[model samples]
Target: MNLKLVVMVFAGALLVSGCSTSKEEMLPAGDHSMLELWNGAEGGGSTARQAAAARESLRRPLTGSERQVDAQGDRSYSRTQEREITQQFPRLPNPDMVMYLYPHLAGGNTPVPGYSTVFPFYSQTQYAMPGERTEAL
Candidate 1:
């Protein structure tokens, strides 16, 4: 019975404390200058309108000095200069050889014609010593 009474008192105190109101500070209203600009309320058009106006705002023709300087700068570099960047290590050439095949019976009973097939004397890739012939036509 004593524990029950203590628990009830604690619960009641907690409920009372939880029900108390806390003081909250209210913030003052701020100036909305950016919002007004976005809405185009200052004689400028709306957001899109302001963007279009801004683009056209700098549409004045370039001055004669600016044109002359730009033309001189553009002529300094040539875009038509051809630069053929060859590989550091050229490919090694392989010698070609002719191979003749005599007419013979192939696959079981079929007689195949004598067709010639040419193949390179060296492999697809071949390495040579420091002082050796490795280039060809």
Candidate 2:
């Protein structure tokens, strides 16, 4: 009985999935011109003028407080700015190892200029977990 029910359910699922794809879906409807589709029933010059008008309509003169906030907002944010109170998970320092290589020839004896490159000491970088000892030894 259980085997019969399982076989029936599997056959039903297969039938439903197979019937989902129709002959009409497999065939393309009509040939559409690339230029006709790109223009999208509108002239390029009229579309550009409409876009400029929309932009002008969306913009307005800033208020006194908004102007002040706008002036202050520019200097307010910094990527390098450190927050003192938000040190829940302090970063463990990953010291970079700089190596200076002398000029050497390549496979075809191509002259390679002397340059300095930096690489981390550890193969995989690790972060210090919260409340872990991260101080320098």
Candidate 3:
């Protein structure tokens, strides 16, 4: 008799533990739905229009106080300031040599001097494999 009672109690406990209640069933008494919080009736059609109107009413152009201007005017950079900027950031030696586009090879334009000159150390023969060697011809 005691064995049967223990088995029944275990089964009951398992059943209760496995049961789950949904969110709506678990909610506290007097809790409101999302529609109620938004001041709209449940399943209402006019809620979208009301929401858009509310958003539109919140929009307004910025006033003079909110507007921004360069208050320093042209007084920020004088001749002395310009000279200091140039001294700090010196101009490149050859700005034209820094070409962004590759010129056509057949266009008959010789590459600028120093561009075609290969470094002597790089041109020398170097062993690529255990016994194999290669050099720029």
Global lDDT of each model?
0.70, 0.75, 0.57
Candidate 2 backbone collisions, by pair: none
**Candidate 3 lDDT over residue span 1-137, tens digit each:** 99999999999998997767666677754556776846765454667668799999999976665543333444455467667755555433321223344444444775533333223334334324433323335
Candidate 2, lDDT over the whole model: 0.75
- As for TM-score, the candidate ahead, 1 or 3, is 1
Worst 10 residues of 2 by lDDT: 78-87
Candidate 3 global lDDT: 0.57
lDDT for residue 105 in candidate 1, whole number 0-100: 91
CA shift of 52, model 3, Å: 2.6
Residue-level error in angstroms, candidate 2, position 4: 99
Which candidate leads in TM-score?
Answer: 2
Error of 2 at 132 (Å): 1.7
Deviation in Å, model 3, residue 89 alpha carbon: 24
Candidate 1: pairs in clash: none
lDDT of 1: 0.70
Candidates arranged by lDDT, highest first: 2, 1, 3
